[model samples]
Target: MPSQSKLLSITTWLLGLLTLVAMATQLTIHLRLNFSLVNFFSYFTNLANLLAALVLIATASLRLASRELSPALESARAVSAVNMAVVGIVFSVLLRNVDLGSLQPWVNVLLHYVMPVAVMLEWLLRPPRTRFTARHVGLCLVIPLVYLAYVLVRGAAISWYPYPFLNPAHAGGYGGVALYVAGIALVFWLVACLLLIVPKRRQVRNH
Candidate 1:
């Protein structure tokens, strides 16, 4: 059987590669003369995504340097990737509807959804050193909650939110956005906890 450390290392390295690719792609789009699908998402969502990608990449380094976080800790990190991916998808879709170029629509979906989904699935199948529990769910919520709060405060002053629904000036407004975010957070928490409970053999057998 593969050691947990090895599985984690592989996942971490793959995430690192993807993170680097995303950074490079964004940089290229910014510097190059070519106009592409890079503008499909709001700048805020893209910025958030870039930060999330950085976090995912840094977790790999943390694992390499000190192996301090548990397998569960790594799993918690997976939720961040998922969160950013989903948010990016939502933002990108909004832009697509506004007549952004097709290339950006494709790139947005590919980067924000496809790549993250593939990487997350790889992590899902790896054997857990410990059973999934309530604590695991708690960890999943913490980071996003902090991030959302920061966004809310910033939105209050700047009157800008990543998505229209999140903006206080919109019809549904910040209240509606807050509710939606809370619901998504709850769903994510439950999903993470359920993932922990699923037996490894059953998960792997499906793969």
Candidate 2:
């Protein structure tokens, strides 16, 4: 029988491969539709999934090689897990009913549902040994903030937004967009706090 760590390594590798395949499938669909590669990659869902895939693959590689995992790598995995969770939540709550023309149902499920849940489960099952500080939480927020700014700026220039909620025209102007952004930011912060706090609480209880 495989040891628990070996099983986990296999699982991570499979999940990472699955994510990459889903992404490639989506990219193929987009290409057939003459979609801009830039626009396709710009979606938070795509970016988050990419990050999750990379982290999963890297962690699995390190584990399989019997290498010591770096704290920074573990931190990256935590951040990726948080981002993916938010991606799933925001999509289900805000864009569930939105018509996503040309997006395959299977691809949608993998990106917005399976990957997110799997990433979070992985984090819960194998948490970082290094405790997350408030500094880590703050650092986790940086990527989303930067992504938000990039989306808004790029949207203004090209008039294309990944999600309807972020589009000023669809969101009832910039005010509405601001409200949506603020709400998502709050959600991200709350989730980050919970992820960090829960681990510490668990460690305390175990001691």
Candidate 3:
């Protein structure tokens, strides 16, 4: 039988490759349908998916390069894993109306759902050795906060927001946008805390 770490490495590497392929394929078709590169990258979903895929690739590469994992790499994995979790939850719970008309059904599923689930599962099942604290959890919000600021400012200026909830023209105005942002922020923090609680997996077979 393959060792647990070996199996996880392989699975994660495969996930990373598949996610990139799916995103690329979808983006190709999407761009052909009057979507500009700037507009495409502006979406939080694409950003989150890109982050997840890149981090997964990094994790896989680190494993390949050496058996011993560095703290930096592990921390990066943690952040990316949490980011993807947020992606899946936010898409399903909040951004249900953002149609992916150009995306094939399977690719859509992979980008929005399966990839996020896979990242979380990989973290839970084969967590790297690192103990995260409340500080780390607090820091986890940094990137998302920056993203929120960017989107809101850009949206306000150009009258274009990626999702309906964040769009001032459609998201019920400033106050409504605040409510949605606050709610999503709360959910993101809570989910980050949950992901940080990686139980010690003692055996591969049992898992």
Candidate 4:
């Protein structure tokens, strides 16, 4: 019989593989229909999918059981988990009006909703052994900051931002961009705090 950890590992691996396939198929269809690879890759949704899948695969491959992940891996998993949730929330709130007829609707749902929920559930179920400190909050911020810089710089050059709010050409302009960044940064921090709380709560329960 498979151990509980082994079962957990297998479950994550299957979910990750499912997410990757759905994402890949959707992206392939999107590229074929739109013929704009650059535009496709620029979306934060795609990046989130990629990040979640990679993190899940890494966890499964390492056979990470319990809440005992190394600090670095724990941080990575936390960031990735939050990124997935952000993708779903942002899509529903900000991008729901955007038509997604090019890709299968089910795949779209999987990428935006199912996978994000799955990642979050995984995070909650497998709280890390190492509780993140306030300082690691800054480290968690780095990935999103880098993502924002990439979008802004690329959009500046090509006049094509992945999201309307992030585009200077849109109504918000630089101010809008700043506002979006600030809002997202706040969200990121809140999510990080939630992630941190899990481990600390578990520690408390143990004592």
lDDT of 3 at 98: 67
- Measured on C-alpha atoms, candidate 3 has an lDDT of 0.81
Candidate 1 regions off by >4 Å? 1-15, 27-78, 81-106, 199-207
Model 3, range 20-93, lDDT digits (tens) per residue? 89889878987888877887888777888888888888887777666666777777778888888888888898
All candidates: CA RMSD (Å): 6.3, 1.5, 3.4, 2.4
- From the highest TM-score down, the ranking of the candidates is 2, 3, 4, 1
Local lDDT at 78 for model 2:
74
Q: Residue 125 deviation, candidate 3, in Å?
A: 0.5
Best-to-worst lDDT order: 2, 4, 3, 1
Question: Which runs of model 2 end up more than 4 angstroms from their true locations?
Answer: none
What lDDT tens digits, residue by residue, belong to model 4 across residues 27-64?
A: 78877776688777777888888888888988887765
Instruction: For residues 1-207, write the lDDT of model 2, one tens digit per residue.
Output: 249989989998998998899899989999998999999989999999999999999999988888877989988987998899899999999999999898889989989999999999888887777788999899789999999999999999999999999999999999999999999999889889888776787788789
lDDT of 4 at 90: 81
- Steric collisions counted per model: 1, 0, 0, 1
Cα-based lDDT at residue 182, candidate 1: 74
Which candidate has the highest TM-score of all?
A: 2
Cα lDDT of model 1 overall?
0.58
- Tens digits of lDDT, candidate 1, 1-207: 246866676666676566557656765765575543333233444554555566556655666576565664566555554455455455555444543332355456646665556445545654444454576667667766776677678678767555555666763866788776776577656655655565445656667
Q: Of the candidates shown, which would achieve the greatest lDDT relative to the real structure?
A: 2
